[model samples]
Target: MYLKSIALVGFKSFGRKTELAFGSPIVAVVGPNGSGKSNVAEAFRFVLGEQSMKSMRSKRGEDLIWGGSPGLPRANRGAVRVVFDNADRLLDLDFKEVVIERVVYRDGQNEYLLNGTVVRLKDVIRLLAGANIGGSGYQIISQGEADRILNASPKERREMVEDALGLKLYQHKKAESERKLGETGVNIDKTKSLRRELAPHINFLRVQVEKIEKARELKEQLAAKLNEYLAREHAWISQEDARLSEEIRMHETELRKLSESVRAARGARGSSSDAALAGLQGKLAEREGKLAAARRESERLARELGRAEGALEANNVTVEAIVPVPHVRNFARELDATVSELERVDDIARVRSVLQDIRSRIKSFIEGLSGAAPVTNEEVKQQVKSLADSLARVREEETNLADELESLRKGIAEARESGFAAERDLVALEASVREAQSKLGGVRAARENIAEARRRFEEEVREGIALVGAAVHSWEKAEIPPGALSEERSVQEKRRRDIERLKIKIEESGSGSGEAVVKEFTQTKERDEFLAKELADLEASAASLKDIIAELEKTIDARFHEGLKLINEALKNFFTKLFGGGYVDIRFVASQEDTRIGGSLGRGARAYLYRTHFFDDAGESSALPRSRRDRRRAR
Candidate 1:
């Protein structure tokens, strides 16, 4: 797949959203210095999951975003997106086109999206790898990058060539395999250590297993005895169940007979009592009516006799003439006339209530004199008080006038009462009402007595009826209800006990005796013994296998170095041709594993040469080329 277009927003010098389109094979991005030419390369790196901020020439994530310049305001985010045309199925995707976008926020958080769906950076790397456009490969080249191939150390140069030749994937696989192999080695060591620790125990288990076998035989004998005992217990339980059922039947028969007898007794009592109470209530009511009539007759005769006696006593008494109480005007009328004529004195001051205020002020003036200053007597405060009291009194006078007007209205009504016949009729009617009141009081007393008697009669009847009904109901309930069959409780108890005993026997067979311990020992010992045999067989098999793997890895590693050397040679030649004239060569650095500490092994050698031409100038004296010891000797 080839890149089709790229978009940059707030990334480096591309402050605004910028889009660049590319054609089939190659697209050259050319611009003057600081015109965002390199920014295009950085954009590619950014979208392709390059995470090295240092390599991108940025100190912090925020540096990638646009900060406000003189003409432009700062943007909150930086983003780079690259679109690819995958019509040739160069990438591991079914789509004809793919878009990869990355955005960096000022807050140091980042996001990546693949085809508008958010994904991880690793996904982008893997996708590029599938397209044969991996990191540090020949697909992308910079100005210095082309020359670096020949200048790089043999190991680094080899890695570069391997990347181009598609060996990088294999190397990655090998590294991953080595990592897993290391972990497996650790696990194997731990397993071996465990086996060593268990060796003594394994021997002990073997002895235990032998004892277990014998114990198991003994357990079989015990289980047989237990089975025989259970059979005997079962027979005993069956016989006892029959006996218990027979006894339960007898008790149930007795209980049933007793219940019937109790029911009959209760029914007889209820019938006899209700009849007697009914008859007695009718007789009592009749007697009560007769007594009430007798009492009434007695009261009537007594009232008549009292009237007769009063007349006789009146006739016997001599009456002196009490001169007709001369139409004495009642004191009420006298009081009214006196109040009306007693003082036609102008009550303006009294009505004004100012007289009370004047008296109050005179009293205060005297009191203030006792504490007065000679120059300005404290009477000023007292005078203020007097004025306030006068104002209040004047208000009171107005209130009193209003009250007098109301009193005048009442007096007018009273004066009119003297000629009101309806009022006189009402008073006469009231006197008759007093007489009726006395009769009503007597009638109320009679009603109260009747009510109390009726209450007592109802209470007695209700209680008697309830008591009799409760007794009857209780007796019926106590009678034996049908379908209630007693259980053979003893038989059930025996069966439960047998079950419990059988369970206990099973547990005893499993754990209580040496048989169980022996069985455990046998199983454990057998397992370990088998493991030991298997381990021996595995060790033997692995011995040859380990040697083969070691030899194979060594061969592969050697061949890898060889192929790497060949590629470096080719890369150097390609670079020399591409540059036209550049004396460039790669040097090899041996691994630490091949180097001796005392420098027994010589310094690494150079193999690849990228030389367009080599010319020696006679006029220029060549620097002395000698070993360090020879140079020191000459000095």
Candidate 2:
């Protein structure tokens, strides 16, 4: 690959766009001193990723850009491009012509481009390294720099030789590898320290994890026991509810029977009451018939008494004997009490018997309290006897009527009493029913409350079980708490308490270091493994660097020795021709001087000395610019 062309724009002295093509293998750039010829070389350096401003004849990025000559417009930035002819593809480029560019901004920023695509400075460096080209190497030599190698310090000289021998790439690789190795060592130390810090925490987490596992196991067992207890409790509650319902149904049935009986009694009374009352009234009318004949006898006696009033005044005649009632206050009170009791007693037989007793007492009382009277007039006695006989006849005919009327009265009274009793019983039965229903309602509310509480408890238990069981495949069939057969409420309560306690234990055991701890451990281990792998890779890179550096050393040695040998032969021929048969010799100033690495190890500058033998009839040594200053200038 050879440089084909170079383009410059706003670069140093080249303010406008400029292109220079180099088609021939050899091209000479000739110009007077200070005519911007050196700027071309600086441009090459700039494009090749040179960072040393002094070497580029500039102190800052702005110095590389055009700063407006007297008659030219000021430019803001600068760019330089070099094109390569890569017909053989030696530069590993697909294009026949490859372009590399570098741009400097007014600011300190700079950019590199390959074939118009923005790239990095290192990309340019690496590409040049492939072709044994460098920004300050043998590729671009100047007349003034011809003796640069001889003027260089021993260490710099050695570096020049290495660059010339195309070992710069290897050196760069070795340096980078060493840098990475150093960084890797630091990282390894940091990783070890991190592991040291985490070790105790991890161990603590391990203990916590063990406790958490135990807690989880306990929770699973508690949940299983709770499920069993809850199911049993539900069954018992259901049975109790059914029993209460059945009892309520029985009470309701009895209430219905009582209600029907009361209704029947009322209906019977309602149907027969008016008819019985009317029949008693007719019997009473018939029983009162003797009073009419007694009334006529009384009227006739009244007239006779009226006529005999005058005669009776002269003769105080005796009347028939009559009894008087007793005047005792207790008798009146007793009579009132009997009458009240009789009012209450709706039974016809009872009323009649009580009335007869009361009448006999009243009559006896009157007789005891008052004296008897006798009939005074003879006509009045005859009239009384006749009326009494008539009354007796009438009473005998209606005696059966009295019995019938009494029977009817008794039936009506019994019916009335039965009706009253039935009403009382109905009222009492309604009250009892209301009381029973109120009690039943309370029982139902309590039962429902219990049911709701049970449902919520069981749901919470199942939810807890599900949470624990999600982590355990065989959790459903796990063993539960002991002895929970018949006592459902106690069993469920125990399970609930156990669940709460287990949860507390779980919290106390450090829930933090459970699944997360496992994940962290796994991730940390992976990170450690990755670090180890990275360390190994860094070590391998260091080893490869060592091999490459050794190889570069060997290459420099072989190439330097071989090149010096060929140069010495060419020098001998040049000396013979320049001075015509002069015997000349060229050798290192010291044995170490011949070797760049070995010579640079010494204190003095690495150099070469020459001796000449002038042959003029007799073989003799002749001087040729023997001063050190002249020799250095020639070099």
Candidate 3:
């Protein structure tokens, strides 16, 4: 590969755009002193990634720019571009032409471009190193630098010789490898530190995860126990409730039947006794009324008879003496008629009239008797006898009525007694009904108890479901031990207690936020693993770089020695032709003291040349004495 063209703008003496194209293998630029010929060479160095201002004959970036001269304004920036011909693929680029550009601003900032794309100085250097080209290499020789190889120190000469032999590429690779190794070591250290920082937190999260797992296990166990206990309790309560319901239904039915029987019995007793008593009481009342009437009639008749007897005793006259017999008989008959009419009359007025008629008749009879007739005492006696008989008959009628009333009262009393007996039987039946009702009440109360127990069981089931999730609904499918229902309530209660204890333990464990903790732990663990992997990779890369550096070192040393030998042979032939005499030898010598190179201390290779029998071979040919200047240069 060879430089095909160079373009410069505002670079030192080139204030305007300029381009130089080298089409042939040899090209020369001739100029007088004070012209800008050397500027072209420096421009090449500037474009090829030169970093030292002193090498470019400048103190800073701005010095590389044109300081305006004679009607020309100063340039603000300087730029140089070098194009390479890559037809032989000597440079690691795909194009037939490679252009490298560098620009310097007055602010001491520099920019690099590769193929017109912005890049870094390191990129340009690396790319150039691949083509065995560098800013400070033997590719460019200045006027005074023609003898610089002879005057340069052995170490400098060795570097120049290495550059000529294309060993600079290996040097660049070695340097780059060393730099990468150092950076990789730093990354490894950082990775280790990160892992160390993550350790404690990961451990803490692990503990929390373990606690969450334990709580989960306890919850599972609690759920199982709850299922068994609740299922059995529900079954038992259901059975008891059903049994109590049946008992209540039976007792209710029995009580209803008994009540009906008591009602029927009461109805029968009431119907019979009430009808009998009512009939007998009515007959007795009727008979008593009849007896009272008879008595009253008898008393009236006795009164009438006494009055008649009094009237007869007062009169004390024999009817025969007082009047004619027929007349007296007629008077007596009239008097008797008057007395019967008075007794039969219910109106006072008619009775009074009848009595007045009798009085008037008696008076008339007396008058008539005064004239002629007399009455018999037998008529009076007859009338009195009739009234007495009437009284006696009424008395007998009252006696018969009293007897009938007494009989009727006896029947009524018997009816009342029968009613009482019926009442007693009704009371007994009602008592039996009450007893049945009492039994039903007890059964109902038992049913209420069972219902309450069922309610409590349902509540427990809900609580279990809340605590242990929907697993509580699975109680129907739970495996129960044989005869579990036959066990005492205490056993079920114990199981319930176990469940409660486990629930409390689970509550105390945590709020189940361990999922988040576990997630975080997983992420942290993954990060740690990734970092560990990265550290391993970095370590591997550093090891590989070291191996590459070692290999490059070996190759560089071997190739450098080989090139040095070839250069020495060329030097011998050239020396003979140039000086027309003597012999020259070039060889490598190791320095006794360590030298600092590329930021590392190492033994340095110094090139030494010995010339004999030309002009200074005054004594026997011996190895050229080491000059103090050369030793100083080596140091």
Candidate 4:
């Protein structure tokens, strides 16, 4: 695989997003020195999982991003992406094109991604390994390391050459296999050690587990018995609940009908009483008005009667004070005798003569009374005259008073009748009110009794149906109310106590103390068994890895010898072409010693080769022969 395109954004020199597309092979990027041309190569290294900050020409994440120019804004982050053409499937991905990206923030945080999916740096490195690309491979020969392979140590040169020769992928595989093989060996040892440690515990748990199994069997039997009773009780309660609910409903319905009747009766009585009361009150008010009129009349009659009596007394005194004609008392008899004598004289002449004679006598009497010392003073005379007139008026008033007294008597009798009628009607209305109150009291008493019964029944239903179980304890809803159960509660209580006691006994015993102990025992046994199988699998894998390593070593040795032969021939011809009469030869070292420090292993030497040349002039001192002391560490 090869780089097809590159994209940079907010990088050290590429503040604005920039992209480069390479459609042809052997694309070269040339620019003046210090013109950020090297950044492009570093960008590739960054995208391909280079972790060395110094190598990217940055000491920190923020330094890798643009620090702002004269008129440009600073970037908060830097990103670089490189795309590869993977149509040949040379890279280990299922895509025609693979894009790898890296981003660094000013806060020293960084991330890697593959085709927009976030990934770790190790994933990117592992993916690129199969493509024979590495951070220090020959695919990217930076100017500073133009001859890096030539100067690299034996091990370092081995890595570089392997990439150039397309063997880096195999080496990576070998490394992974070796790492797995080593881990397998460690796991095998741990399994053996763990099994040894758990043996005593497993034996102890076995004894306890046997006891727990027996307890569990007893528990199962108890649960079965309990469930059977609960089921029966549940069914019985359900049936009885329906019946009780129906009965209660009927009772409530009857009570409601009775209550409605009572209310209706009350309404009727209230209307009747109200109407009666209004009529009685009106009659009472009317009678009171009539009584008030009667009282006023009585007072007026008494005042008139009193004034008449006073005037009559004064008249009597006046009559006495006046000198009455001396024959006034005898004159009334004389007049009566003359009127009788005139009646005896039937002749018209004789009758007229008799009336004249009577008139003459009355005149004689008045003249005699006036001449006799009667009213000799004019004042006395006027008084006597006034007394007479007053006496006449008094008589007239007395006549009028008698007639008025008769009418007042009639009015009093009518008012008495009206009062009696009102009183009788009031007494009847009061009787009705009392009767209605009595009926209302009885209805209220009945309603209270029924309401109390309903309350008691509701409480009984709530208590009778409540069921407590092992897993759940809450009020269970029934569509309708239920009646009390027939089964004695004592039997259920006894069974419950038995269940509780059994549970307590299990807790006291060492076997099934708690759920956690059972879980631990089961998990521990499973883990021990799993470890045994894992140990067998790991041993098998370790053996297979050893065979693979041996095969790889043999293949590498034979190939290395053949590669040396071919390179020696090519160098001989290349020296002849460059300078006449020159010979060159390359040969592999026989063996290498692994370095050690204080009995601990260090770096191992990898088989490599050196080239020799003879030009007859004998110059350049054998091209500075390479050795372990002079070689630097590999990239």
Highest TM-score: give the candidate number. 3
Cα lDDT tens digits, model 4, 120-239, are: 876787788777686664666777685665555555655555565555555555666677777888888988999889888887777778777767665565555445444444555555
How many backbone overlaps does candidate 1 show? 1
Question: What is the Cα-based TM-score of model 1?
Answer: 0.38
Cα-based TM-score, every candidate: 0.38, 0.54, 0.63, 0.47
| Cα RMSD of predicted structure 3 | 12.1
Best prediction by lDDT: 3
Worst 10 residues of 1 by lDDT: 319-328
Query: lDDT per model, in order?
Result: 0.53, 0.63, 0.76, 0.61
Model 3, span 258-304: residue lDDT tens = 98999899889867678888988887776665666556655766776
Task: Give the clashing residue pairs of candidate 3, or none.
Answer: 319-375, 320-375, 322-374, 323-373, 323-374, 324-373, 324-374, 328-375
Error of model 1, residue 292, in angstroms: 99
lDDT tens string, model 2, 1-635? 88889999999999999888897878888889887898998888888888999888888999999999789987999999999988878675688878999998999799889999998876777677767775555677766677775455444554655576565665565455556655766776776677677677667766766666786676667556555545555555666667667766775676677667657666765667656656765655544442333333334434433444443344455322221122234455565566456445545466466555655665564354335443435433333343333334334434644565577667667756766676677667667667766766776776687678668756765665455654333334544445533555675577667767766676676564367766776676666667667667766765675566556545655666675566567767887888776555433344334544331234353443443334443566543443466567757
TM-score of 2: 0.54
Name every residue pair that clashes in candidate 4: 241-482
Candidate 1, 1-635: lDDT as tens digits: 67789999999887888999987576677878889887788778778887889757798899999887888899899999989999998777889999999999999899999899999776777677655565663555666886666455444555555566555444444444445445555655665776777777767755665545444444454344333333333334344445445544554554455455445544544565445545545444443443333334234334433543353244442211211111112222332332233123234333223333333433443343234322121223223333333334334433544455455445444434432443454455455455445444545554455456446434533432332222222222232324222344465356445544544444544433355556666676666666666666556545544454455445545666687567557756775687564433333434444322222222342233221222233322222212354357647
The better candidate by lDDT, 1 or 4, is: 4
Order the candidates by TM-score, highest first. 3, 2, 4, 1
Misplaced by over 4 Å in model 4 are 23-28, 60-62, 86-96, 106-110, 117-123, 183-200, 214-516, 544-548, 551-566, 595-623, 628-635
